[model samples]
Target chain A: MVSDNFFPQPGGVESHMYQLASKLIDRGHKVIIITHAYPGRTGVRYLTNGIKTYHVPFWTIYRETTFPTVFSFFPIFRNIVIRERIEIVHGHASLSNLCHEAILHARTMGMRTVFTDHSLFGFGEAGSILTNKLLKFTLSDVDHCICVSHTCKENCVLRASLDPSMVSVIPNAVVADNFRPLSQNEIDSRRSSAPGPPQPLGPNDTITIVVISRLFYNKGIDLLIAAIPRILASQPNVRFIVAGSGPKAIDFEQMVERNVLQDRVSLLGPVRHDEVRDVMVQGHIYLNPSLMEAFGTVIVEAASCGLYVVCTRVGGVPEVLPSHMTEFAAPEEDDLVAATNRAVAKLRSGKVRTDLFHNQVKQMYSWTDVAQRTERVYDSISTTRSFALIDRLKRYYGCGIWAGKLFCMCAVVDYLLFIFLEIFAPRERIDVCKDWPKKAVPVAKLGEEEDVESLKEGGVPGRKRNSRHRREKRDETDESSAA
Target chain B: MTTLITILTRLASPPPQTLHTHQPTSSTVTYTVTTRPALTGLCAKLGFYVGISARVVLGMVAVLVVCLKWCVSLGIGISVLGAFWGEGGERGMRRIMKLIEITDGTYIIPLAILVLFLACKRNYKEESLTIISGLGLQTSTTSSFYLRSPSTRFISTTAIQDIFIHEAFKGFEVRFYLAVVVEGEREVVVVFPSMLPRRGILEEVWREGRKCLWEMGEKG
Candidate 1:
């Protein structure tokens, strides 16, 4: 598996990639990640779980998205794909140019490809148009596509114009046990234990609202800034703890100053993910004023921390948490203020059972569940499509008018490159990296053996080595009923 | 120059860099100001207090956001209202929106080439909007940075330089209200606010601009 987002980047997509990759590796699938060089990071590095990662040096255009150099990534990528004898290429993160380039090159090389879109994009902006087109071009010939949520699948089908059948809806899973909410007794003891923490509020104490996200425009920093003053003015015994940093940082700061919320609102700036729980435990409400999302895992994380959620009703946010845990607000300034007020009122009135959110959230997600779902995706691709690269191209060719033709052309060029590389950069000549001491999947006896035999020909890259768990191999073969 | 870079470098993180630890010695009830430097703002404090339309405010903010996000220079100047000189929303009054549209349009190489095709053409058809008696860009002389709040989030909006387009061409002669297409796409409105118009043609000229825009959209 190849992915662009990994550890170091603090976002939902980044976390999803890390969790999925780690889980896949634990399932005995050899996963190698390919991402652009991040600050202070260079060359190939092995993450803790023996997962190898290659960070290619590339110029960053906006945020961490690499400058799109379409054909430039081909030569090096071809070398890696060939060296690994990779039969399948899996790309992650929609914004990563590296991921797009790999998918394009992999398709060109006649390898089965899977693309995972972690974020949802709207059809409205010009930026979305270009992004969607680029997405269309890459996905035009890919073998299969994966989306974090059903909403994201719909978005991908519309944007890339792919058939819904080929796109799998695999929601991102959170490491639920990590976020355990404090109990009332625990909260009181902790407050007392702290030698005088903000004493546990007896229903009338100040309610703390937490906002944690990058201060970018798309994150709706403008809405956050606009609503802060209104939220503070309406509720006197309310305090804000905003932890983020971006271009909108100044805008939020200005709001704080204009309202003289110096004592009331505290900007904690950016914080690490591990510390999110600690900061969240201090707050009663979690406010997410994001403009768009594919799967709002942060809201899940917030709910897991037992904070009542107040979020803009855009993208997939409305579907993330049940109404009991969250209050939905339209993506409008007035609506957001009103929703926040409602959430505060609900908290004061004891109507919202926020204390029960932690256990509920833990039940909703797990890395193991995500791994099993991903395994199903791999099964569907290999079992359903028969390693037939042409059939995969046929799936991609259904993308759109000009996009379909362009994708076929990309696939043809990649096939030609594969033949050329076979002649010049012979696979026999390149050294195959040894597997990291993983147990082999013993070919199961009986009818299950025939299915595994068929999969061997169309196996995912690094899958040929060994299936460490015979249980998973048996469980996956029984896959027709998977959701 | 050093201060500018420092200010920019600081923009990456949110306000209040040093997190307050919940310690016994810490002032839990009383809030103290963070040690962040109170560097002069890129705009005046009172500027953001009053309401400014997206057209005006976004234009001024674009000078920085674009420079940071796109790594390009954009010159935005706004002046008071005057007579229409045919540039219409594309140039004078809606400079911010126009600039965004143009930049977004030109950002793609294919669209850039398309725009280049329009730029090369010499003479073209011209249509008229309402021959306004007076209409101009709400232009303002650019102000240097002043009184910037240190604990701000997102973009530090600079003081607005409103460029108003006068309604000079709002009531004008039919003949003077000419719509000329430059290159392949751009339509320029060249009526001057200072230019005298023929009597009783104002309403006709006003009607023509809308018709022209509608016609262009249909043709496009």
Candidate 2:
């Protein structure tokens, strides 16, 4: 996986990469991550489950995104690709400069490339125009593209002008075990225990609505600020627990102070990823008033934590959760207020069966299912013939009048640089690294272990036998020398 | 002299290191020459000097143009020249011309030469790992310039701990290097710090060095 976002930096893409890579490793595929080095985190490090990561040193310009020095990353990237014997270069995130460069260089080196678009872009803004141009350049010749949702796929297809068949919709999944709701036994014990805070809400009890998103303008924080006071005023039994911090947080604070609703509104600034479940279980309703989203993995997580989701109907948010579990609203203050009231009424009336949401969500989305789908993508791309230089240039030339020629020139120059590297730093001289020792799958996961064994049997018989024979011969030599 | 083996390897940079193993008398001397002959031909040196001179001249001309355009008006330019040639005229003009010539030759030319020299210079001319049977290990680095003496350390057979090839992150990528862990030292001494050859070369060195050290240990 190649991306600018990875672990130690928390975001949807980072967790998505981690989960997918680890799950792919579980399916007997050797996975490695290539990302720019974070502060004090340069070098090759091994994450859990033997996923080797090469943190290439890079200059980060803003918000952990590397400066787009197109050709400068080629040498080091080529070295890593050669050393790892990488067959497929999978790039993630449209905003990542490293991902774009890797996709270009991988194509130059005649390797199959896959790109995943995680966010949606509009065709109207200048920033989006530039980003769309870049997306067109990189996705012009990519083997296949993956988007987090159907809406995201359409947006990416429109932005890059890609064939709909070449793009697949693979939703991001939450680790269900991590986002599990409070069990009935735990809830009952909390309620029956002496002198403790109320655990379960009565019919007339104060319903705590949870809002856990970065308070930004695009997140519809202004609508949230407007809706909060009205929701509290109309529904005397409703309160709010807001988490996350951003520029618009001051607006929320001012709104709360202006309304004298300090006792009802509690602000928990910037909760970590692991603590999201604990916060989610405290509320009966989860509110996500974002202006736009690609997948909205957080709502699935909220539903898994047994909270009824009240979200804006924008981008891909409507497609994420089932209608029964979610209350959708337009991106307006009054609509959001109505949605939250509806959710609160449903919760009070005991009409929504939130207690069973965890199991249903687990059945609906899983990393295992995502990994299987991604493997199918990899399998399909592996068989598809890669385009030659001329064909690739032709495709690039169809992007725009001026951009087409510019992209063609860039591809031609990248190909020349590849040829230069191949001649000067010959591939024979670059040493292939030994793979990290694979851990034996625990007996608890016997089904997966058997599946992997079967996959090995069905996949590359000669290479597997050759490596085993080499190991046996080495052992024999060691034994002979000992004797 | 009987040469046992020779290995040639290149680093990320252009210059290649050639490792030579000599089995003379009872000792094994394995040394690598890291310094390639600097700017070999006279034509190359002349070309480099000419290029530097052209760059310096062009830079001076650009600076003069920019100064004339932005820093000084045409009247000031002529007045400055007039001041140089007008008052205390001949002697001052001659002295200023001499100062310019001296500055050109002494300052800029030598600075360029120093840069060329530094670019061509290596910290160590050669590094060697010697194993005399029953006498432990000896590693030395010969200085490229005469300003610093060669650094040599001999680990007695008893003090020698272990020699192995290890992988480390150098700059942007992971690299393989050979290191010697002394008996009591906190840090292991890297064998070749400057020219870190590939893993194949490092593995060969590790195997041969360990065999020489341990085989002799058993014999003695």
**After superposition, candidate 1 runs with Cα above 4 Å error:** A183-186, A193-203, A386-409, A439-483, B1-220
Worst 10 residues of 1 chain A by lDDT: A460-469
- Residue A419 of model 1 has an lDDT of 59
Q: In candidate 1, what are the lDDT values of residues A24-45, reduced to their tens digit?
A: 8889787777787676555544
Best-performing candidate as measured by lDDT:
2
Fnat score for model 1? 0.00
TM-score of 2: 0.75
- Per-residue CA lDDT of model 2 for A63-145, tens digit only, reads 79999988888888888888889999999999999999999999999899999999999899998999999999999999999
lDDT of 1 by residue, B1-220 (tens): 6665455445542333121112232111111112233335756434433323333453444343343224322333222211233446544446543454456533544544444333332221111122111221111111122222222111111211111111111211011222222222222333322221221232233233323334333454
Residue ranges of candidate 2 with Cα displaced over 4 Å: A193-201, A439-483, B1-125, B128-139, B146-148, B152-174, B178-189, B204-220
Q: Calculate DockQ per candidate and list them.
A: 0.00, 0.11
